[model samples]
Target: MTDAPRPRALGRKSIRPSLVPRDLMGDEELAGVWTAQVITLLPQAFPGVLGESLTGRALQEGVWALRTIDLREFGEGRHRNVDDTPAGGGAGMVLRADIGAKAMAEAVSRARGDVPRLLLSPRGRRFDQAMARDLARRDGVILFCGRFEGVDERLIEQFGLAEVSLGDFVLTGGEIAAQALLDATVRLMPRVLGNHHSAEEESFSSGLLEYPQYTKPAVWEGRAIPEVLLSGHHAKITAWRQAEAERLTKERRPDLWRDHLAKLGRPEEDREL
Candidate 1:
């Protein structure tokens, strides 16, 4: 009798050189899987929280992939220096343009397809759910995590890097922001989450903050689960959720509420009603 067809392995083929040992790399290079390429000084900082829970599970399963390009690997000089003092004189060192250009060139060469090369910066466009959704639909992304004061402007310009920020505030490095951005983007990929509906219903998916959720313990601390949720009426439950979501958005985020209204072609004045 002929043997049954073997199940395909989820692992990917390793296409690029890495400082990480092959065995510890978890998922190998798999074509078609969404990937995140990170350029950072602290190579060990990743997979970080991305290596836990659903995102971690996805990484292991080859549903997605992660490749960390150590910036220090491309550092100049015998000591492997990657940063220098600001040209006009600044309080902190700036990443050298020459070093950054070399690192970026390596990242570009390793890209599987046309992908975004992002720089995490305090002055860049604010990251949001829409951006996450957009990235999730792409082949992958290359993130450059800046350190010290920041990267040289010449490097940013030469590479045409898109600067993205988590908020107005700054951090010691871009590693944390890169992780956060990856977490947000990766979860939106197919099969990453246990239930696809989770992404569709989460906060900002509908252009409004998510409604509060309750589970079990029909009554908690003298408060009961919203009666509608207990009624077993699907229509009523959905309506209640939509109303609550709108109420929360209108009260807590006027800007979002206005945007939501505008999307629906409603006038801002109607929000008062």
Candidate 2:
């Protein structure tokens, strides 16, 4: 008997490295990937560990590009500071609109195509897998990372910044969120992760949470792998995993599972959950 051949990727690899032929990208034409430019009061604050991990590897390999702009570079007056007290009397300092605006404009001038400008803010649309996939297809992006209280709202409005939020929680600054957005997005770019299937099978890939995964050790601390997984029948194993994934989602994140069901056009089922 022959071993099962590796499952062929439906078409070309998600990421056909530029070194490869251009015709391979299918009709998608992965000609220009999105470049990210983060505008912040402290540019050095960026490319932190977030940039060093898998995301950093993507940058190094030219899967994507990142640029950080210090808003102070465009500050007015002798001090070169880029923030000021809020006009309406806020708790902390607010980043000046003029400075941020100028910096973002400069970043815009440096990049190509219609870029989606994002302002990491508490008042924006919550970021999620759908947002990540959407951003990955764009040509470029400019992330405005607010410091102190926040950036001048007028600048965000005038620049048409799409206010994006990571969650309801607050953070010290938007730089962290920007980095997170970058990391999530770069991974979606073709070829960033060598195993393309990993992306397709991971949580949120199929609009459903990922099924649990296990490794070589059959037992650890007396905890054994599930009996079904140990069963040699391939069909039974796949069915068990799908059932388990659905059950886990129903138990842990019923809301997500509900949405998934809706997407699947399933009849609504009332649950005490």
Tell me the spans in candidate 1 whose CA falls farther than 4 Å from its real position. 1-5, 11-28, 270-273
lDDT for each residue of candidate 1 in 110-196, tens digit (9 for 90 to 100): 788768989999999999999999999888999999999999999999999999999989799999999999999999998888899
lDDT of each: 0.87, 0.77
Clash number for each model: 3, 1
> What value does the lDDT take at residue 142 in candidate 2?
90
Against the true structure, what is each candidate's TM-score? 0.91, 0.83
Off by over 4 Å in 2: 1-33, 270-272
Q: Which run of 10 residues does model 1 get worst, by summed lDDT?
A: 15-24
- For lDDT, the strongest prediction is 1
Write down the lDDT that model 1 would get: 0.87
Clashing pairs in 1: 12-29, 12-30, 13-29
101-202 in candidate 2: lDDT tens per residue?
788888778777867989999888999988898888888789988778887879978888899999999998898899888888888888788888888878
